[model samples]
Target: MNPVVYTVDLEVRWRDLDAFNHANNASYLGYIEEARVRWFKSLSADWAGETAAPIMAAVQVNYRRPVNWPETVRVELFAERVGNKSLTLGHRILSACDGDVLYCDGHTVLVWVDRGGQSVPLPDAVKAACAG
Candidate 1:
């Protein structure tokens, strides 16, 4: 198992559900994104600056169970790997009421990009932040 570096609790909204009364498939991506953004902000307050921002390159998600509204989900984020120009993040979305029940799991790769949207080597500061 990857080490969890950050975690957040997000509420399931009514609109997130589908005809089956469970969260739509696309909603899981938003949940993971919320955790990722929060983790980035925790690493650096000015993480959104133009010159050294990261962009999502790819994402892969596996749904384990359905989630319903009026519930709180726990999203755990991990810094699985730090590369020269990218960061590989692992995530687990669990049922807040019961931590052992996993709702979804995924990985995302973020590439560091410059103002012109070209890939660049990650900054030293960014590396240091992930080292923890």
Candidate 2:
């Protein structure tokens, strides 16, 4: 099955800019987080339930180009790897107006954990969702 790709469009707010007048590096992560959350919600599963939740284990981001204000950025996410206890999500940030203009790319690793913070196998529903 083809992996599901999730996309979200976000406006570059003025507050997201830094001294260079472009979006701050931290802002890019925030954008990715928003898109990731939205995607998780779309799955319609209790991925963040009290009994078990997915926690970020690692994150890697590569900034390709600066993003200016008054622009809309499209954040795309897809499952890169779905393991027994962990999932790696690949992401790309591109100009919504000009899709060819890529701003950033990255991946985040999420591990399922129980209430005691011990790693657990991912829920079948989550795996099915990732499988698209």
Candidate 3:
């Protein structure tokens, strides 16, 4: 298992619940996105709106179990791979009440791009910051 480099604790909102009484499938992505964005912010205050920002190239998620409301969720993020122009992030979402219950796990590929949307090598600062 990859070491958790960053983490965010989130509550499963009432609106996030589905007809089955568990968090909706789409809500999982939002949870992971929150953690990912926070990770970038930790790297730099201006990372979110910088001229050369990173964008998601692809995402793969595996749902392991259902999550219900009233339970806190812990999102763990790890920097997996850093490439010339991209970085892969590994993530795990688990029930805060019991860390052993993994609700989901996934990976996201992010590509650095300039304002013009042309691919560019990740800034040295980002590369160094995310090195694990």
Candidate 4:
């Protein structure tokens, strides 16, 4: 277990709520995505355009508790393993106020892709940043 390298905060929005007044199941995936994006931006030299941006090959999420609107959501992202072409990032969503965990999750298997979308080995910089 390594310290999370990326932390992103998301404020719950009205649109994020479901009929039950809690964050919808689908919205949880968006929250997870925020953390991953933050992680990539930090680890990659040019995530927005120049360098390769990793793509998700798979995702697994387990919702533990419902989140109501107006709550500040905090997400932490970290990697479990760094392979030649892919890595598994660990994700956690929690309430910023009480620290109640809303979801405990595993990552999307991410592989580096070139501008042409061909799979490539993670760059040395990415490998160093993701190494745990």
- Top-lDDT structure, candidate number: 2
Tens-digit lDDT track of model 2 for 8-77? 9999999999998999999999999999888877776586887988899999999999999889999998
RMSD of 4: 1.9
- Candidate 3 residue runs with Cα over 4 Å from true position: none
TM-score to true structure, per model: 0.92, 0.93, 0.93, 0.86
Per-residue alpha-carbon lDDT of model 3 for 1-132, expressed as tens digits? 767789999999999999999999999999999998888888877674667888999999999999987899999998889899998999999988899999999899999899998998987767877776
Q: How big is the RMSD of model 1?
A: 1.3
lDDT accuracy of residue 29 in candidate 1: 97
Please say which candidate is ahead in lDDT: 1 or 2.
2
The C-alpha RMSD in Å for every predicted model, in order, reads 1.3, 1.8, 1.2, 1.9
Best-to-worst order by TM-score is: 3, 2, 1, 4
Q: List the residue pairs that clash in candidate 4.
A: none
> Which 10-residue window in model 1 sums to the lowest lDDT?
43-52
In angstroms, the error of model 4 at 3 is: 2.5
93-132 in candidate 1: lDDT tens per residue? 9998999989998799999898888888976766786787
With candidate 4 superimposed using the best TM-score fit, by how many Å does residue 94's alpha carbon deviate from the native? Answer: 1.0
Off by over 4 Å in 4: 48-51
Q: Which parts of model 2 are misplaced by more than 4 Å? A: 1-4
Superposed Cα deviation of residue 117, candidate 2 (Å): 0.7
lDDT of 4 by residue, 1-132 (tens): 666767888898899988899989889889988777766677665754565667889888877888887888898877777888887787888887767555556566788888789877877766777664
Instruction: Candidate 2: give the clashing pairs.
Output: none
Comparison by TM-score, 1 against 2, better one: 2
